[model samples]
Target: MTFNITTKNLDTFKSAFIAALLAYIFVYGFELTHFTLSIDEEPLDNFLQTLSAGRWGHALLRHYVLPEPYAPFFTTALSIIILSLSAATSSIYIGLNKLQSISFVIMLAALPQLAYQLEFSNQADTVSLSFLLSVVALFMIEKMSVIRASAFIMLTVVSLSVYQSIFLYAATLTCIRITTDAIKGQIIFRQALKKIFVFSLLITLSLIINSFLAKWTALYFDVTISNYLTSMIGWGKRDVYEVLKSVLIFMRDYLTFKSAYGINAFPFVLLSLITIIILSIKRKRGAPLIILMGFATLLSGFLLNFAIGSGMPPRAMTQIPLVFAGLFAAALVISRVRYIGLIISIIFLCIGSAASNKLFYSDFMAREADQNLSNQIITTIYNNIPNFDEKVTPVFFYGSYSPLNSWKIPSADVFGSSFFDWDGGNNRRMYMYLSTANLIKLKEPNEIQVKNSIVAAKDMPSWPNRNSIKIFDGVVVVKLSDKLSPYNR
Candidate 1:
């Protein structure tokens, strides 16, 4: 079987229209709100300020700003434009019909977790991922030319500079593209191996260039690049065993707690496997290589997690589903039962889109209620607390509070909204908001410099982590009784 590259013009207008419509519906219908201030916003805000102040060098190499360089506005918008163009080009290379491409774009635009990332996650990893995909799409679709190859290298460097985790995506896309090509007989096993070898070298080259670029850019800006890059290059306190353990845990979570994410990939991977098996039975020459490449693609995410040594939220994790979508499109184009493949792709996509919409809508309403309550309580506290800016307040929260209680109905995700949910993880921030003063966490008896304040919920007589309600040493202990506003309710 000889693989012939077929040229088909995708209805770019239809794809873009559907993508835009779905985006609008989700943004409006779900009321997905972006917060002005969040856990991750502080550094981004600082970076923006630095850029505005012409301290571009300091912004990228600022203290406590690690994990990636900060070039938000330019990188983000450029990435989005590149991604859109990449999608359009992919439709032609993969021989996707207008409907198929539209569905793919809709999934890209509407997946709830990805939507959450775009709305919240500070756009660093997400936009970097977009850049990585664009690199893959452009490289795969365009005929190899000196200029084109150089452009791919440049984009690849930019993608890596933005986020080191992009190596995971770069590897995943390369595997899928190579496997898809082999399955389509566009390349034999030898050619597929050569492509993989060349892609690996490109990634290595990109990593080296990005490091020099990061240091060079920092020097140009008169900033210092921290030793954090050492860890990013897979050298840190976490040993290989520890990293492997974390990766295993992450994999387990993906199959259970994060299974909805895996839904998009698992089915498509299975279909690809079955397709390869059938083709192998028919004496196909490159089926085994396709199988190997497909497995490599599946494991790429885990390897990335190990390298990062932490579990990332949906924003970064969405790369897996996107890779799965690309593989599905490639497989659909080449399958004998193309209609059946398309139907499965459509069904999986519809499920993912519906789940994403429902997840966000429920989270949106919860956030609205939480925000209102938070504002009211903070304002009330502000009104009552004296010397609000000059004192220290230690808060002990009573009563079990959960975001699930804020929803009008049972919320779509049991995990709760990332930004709105106030659990043990964020109790300190909420307390700071409530007190409007300096916060001091009391582990044991300690001397108070400023006025010591204590706050408890309405039903706080019996709660874990409770401090004594009795006033002592001129500490102003305030109990938010039932007589005050209904905060605990």
Candidate 2:
């Protein structure tokens, strides 16, 4: 009997894995095969050379999975495999039936946030592994023995260390399990409350431990924790009431498609929720609990936003997709009209896949435009600057380039942004791009030289003008724009 059960589990995992793999291939085949570069990946040529920036778990995983010089195909393929494994594990742990399991993996693969995360292909596998660990930790939380609890904490800590945003993913999963089990009559309301309390306490403990470990890791690496992560939380930075209001407003915007990317999942989420509610009411078991938990599941997507007292990028809002997947799964399990649920899931998958294709195609076009502009600037600099030696001439970029390209396709965040226009990293990105392309080895200007170039660039013309590419104080200053704001400088 044990062997038979093991075989069944393996078969379930295999089925889910195949479903997820096919879904991702349909959505991201172009990105997997094509050499695509996003703003962040432009300067991130060597993965190991980069600092951990408080993401020690991601750093460690990248050390093993991604070494040096980004390989688009390899990184993308590995990411797909890891994410498919995560989907399979989730399906097995959640006790999803065959149809629901297929729906779950399909929705997971079609998530827009996953597409955005893959934009930074160098660390995509690490992020995917973090996601897998988050799901695994939640799955382990179901039994809640001493050993399992310890494993849960360890997994949660590692997941957060790799990528903090996935904590919301785990939290949403926990809420989904509690709510769904209660509604399905698998667990009483009292049992649901107890599980919630236990899971919350363990998750809180894991977070505290993660915080301490992060601080220790920073010290050990001789690196100061980046304020980007630390400052995201609004413990003392925001008023309590103000933060609450902002979080609610942000959630409303996100759900209503006011603040979303590509194809919005709001319609599908609403349909799934309605289906679940109607099915639960018909059964008349834990109907009130189902309604309350349904709301909780919806709110779980923005739990991190509530904690941080602000909004986040599309990649950070991964829980939204997870929420959609859970709702669809719940509806599938309870509804007599399983075909309706399956059809909705398939439609969502097709829409999301189409959007993913358009997004990648736009990104490819943007990269081409950026490369053309870079080449033009390089040629102009070499021709205009008398005896310009790239090895010796210190190059400083003042301001940023905003090319007129078709890449601006209504993205909710940084997905469509160009490397040349990435604020505060224009010079580094350009230098790395040139070096990686073997076009030139431009010398990077020091702090003082950069400051001087900024000051001198105020009087110079922007790009396409004769005075845009000029030598200022023995440093080549390429003023891509006239507005030299301190933020971009």
Candidate 3:
């Protein structure tokens, strides 16, 4: 007998292992992998900075997610909570047979676009999926009963309190229930209905509590902080196409194998095909519509972003791909296209996701500044400030998300808790520290109304590699063109 090992098979398996490792790394290093929001690492970072600044008041709203008129938790916080749950469930999937294990992992991975709601986009989304998948795996592995399936369905929807991913959870659960004839028996339906009802009630309560807490926090911080809000009064009525065009440009930043934004266009469509495949196998038809609606929900959310505001970036459509990628993987496994097909599916996801990481996150991970001008200016202040709490040091910026305030500057806000767009509060310290764009605007910002706001010694913009100061009444007013610089501009 002769045995041979092919490099191709080894290579495929090795790559798969490494790919999973990369995802694990990204889970923890998410903060360094994405551009995040302009103000900071999205609201979660701002909320944390608020907490660091002893401004817990604003931190609450900075972390939750919910329907309109009700903020549940900041995207970051939601991601964390959901991811944790999914990971815990993954542990449960372990020790199972290959078919069951793969099924669980595949289904858990193909979830809604709830992960990017925070720092580690895929992690939390995977986690939420794990919970739903766990129930399915349990049904497949243990004493399967209609009551257990129905109860699991209710818990999956109700306990999570995130409606965005609910469609996937609902569809997947219903499929298992009806097709397996586990929970679809009309007599059993009544029990499942009660469970769902109770779950819904609990979800509403959670949302209500979260909303109340977040609103209280923001309001409290608003009192002590003065923020400047640039009035784009006419921005509301500006041409939607222009904004859409601009948004598209920004999103383009994520494509080209440089980032993880494009490619969602096709996968989204593929989801429909996969949905059909899955439905055909299962005796359940209603479940597929539920899954399709899940995609629609994410699309509607993204579309709303474009219609109401300026244009959206094609990259913003990432959520579509992310969720569909999950669905695609599940469909592939369930499709039973031989083990060979399964291998190919994983390969595609690995390569595509890796390319995205490189494109959208390279600058962030590298911390490579586009220009030295912003650096020159911030460096000047940090180096020149004398005796800040016994050190000749200056803090670069202050925000609710920052760690420390600069004592070198008199009346310096320790955190940017108060920033632009406040009607009335205590953020005069921030407006004093202007961006290069604001420095050259000519019109004195009416927002700087605080009594003793620091005088910028260099209001002029400075470019990377060249630093000069233009001071009027001790306020720096010179302009250097380094807007392309990374970190802060």
Candidate 4:
């Protein structure tokens, strides 16, 4: 009996894995096969650099998926496999039937947030591993004992150390689990609350331990923790209110198919929710509690944004897939229309795949445009300077490039934005691009030179103008725009 049970479990996992893998391939195949680089990934050509950001787990595991010779293809494949494993683990932990499992995995693959995470291809595998770890922690803590709780805490810390956003993923999973168990009568409402309380305590403990370890690791490595996330933390009333409002607006936009980074399955999601509600009313269960828990599970994805008192990028909203999956799963369980649910899942998968391909195409075009502009600038520098390579010509960019009219596609966060956009790191990004291309050896201007160049560039013409490229005091100053922001200056 044990052998048969183990074999059955393994087969279920395999089926879930295969379903997830196919769904992911259908949606993100273009990205996995192509070499695409986002702004943050530009500096991660041959090495992983998240250690300084206290992402020791990411830094350590990223070594295995580092894109060396094959560029992005290998890393993308590995990342997809890890993400499929996460889906499989989640399927088993949730105890979904085969059809429900397929629906869940399909929904997971169709997540727009997953696409955003893949944009940073170098870290994609590590992020996927972090997600898998979060699911595993949830699975281990199902029968919470002393040993299980300790293991769950350790796993939670490791997942958070890999990517801080995954805490939301794990928490969202807990919320979904509680709601499902309560609705299915597998656990009473009181037991569900107790489980939630225990899970919350463990998660909190894990967070504290992770925070301290991150600080200690940074200190030991003599590296400063990146303020990218920390700088956003605050309890200011106005900002807090704005973030809360934005969260609601984001949900509305997403559900209405108005959000740029939302899966095009709002109709399906709406239908599923309606079905769940109807079934709850028919069953005469605690409909109010189920509704409340369901909403909490959905909102849990954005809990980090509320805690930080700011908006987060789509990549940080990684639990979005889980939200939709849980909704669909609930509908599948309560409603007799299982085939309809499967059909809707297939439709969602198709739409998501189409969207992913569109995004990949847009990114490809953006990279091409960026490269062409860089090459044009390089050529102009060589032509104008004549002795460009003879001496150290420190390049100073006065303003940043905006692909407003240059590209036809609408920008979605960092998806279609130029690398040279006014993000306060345009100069460094440009330098990195040029260096990586091996087209030209350019020197970065010092702080004083950059300041002086900005002042001098005030009188210079913008790009496409003959006077835009000029040399002053052996520094090559390229003025991209006549208008300069305080950040660029």
TM per prediction:
0.67, 0.93, 0.46, 0.92
- Model 1: lDDT equals 0.49
Return the TM-score for candidate 3, rounded to 2 decimals: 0.46
In model 2, which runs have C-alpha deviations exceeding 4 angstroms?
1-6, 45-52, 485-489
Locate the minimum summed-lDDT window of 10 residues in model 3.
407-416
Q: In angstroms, how far off is 159's CA in candidate 1?
A: 2.0
Candidate no. 1 TM-score = 0.67
Candidate 3's error at 1, in angstroms? 47
* lDDT of candidate 2 over 56-141, digit per residue (tens): 77766665656543576888898889989988887776677667788788887666668878877867888888889998887666
| lDDT, each prediction | 0.49, 0.77, 0.34, 0.75
lDDT of 4 by residue, 297-409 (tens): 76776687668766666677677778888778877776645777778788878878888777876777787887788778888988898888623779888777765424334
Worst 10 residues of 1 by lDDT: 436-445
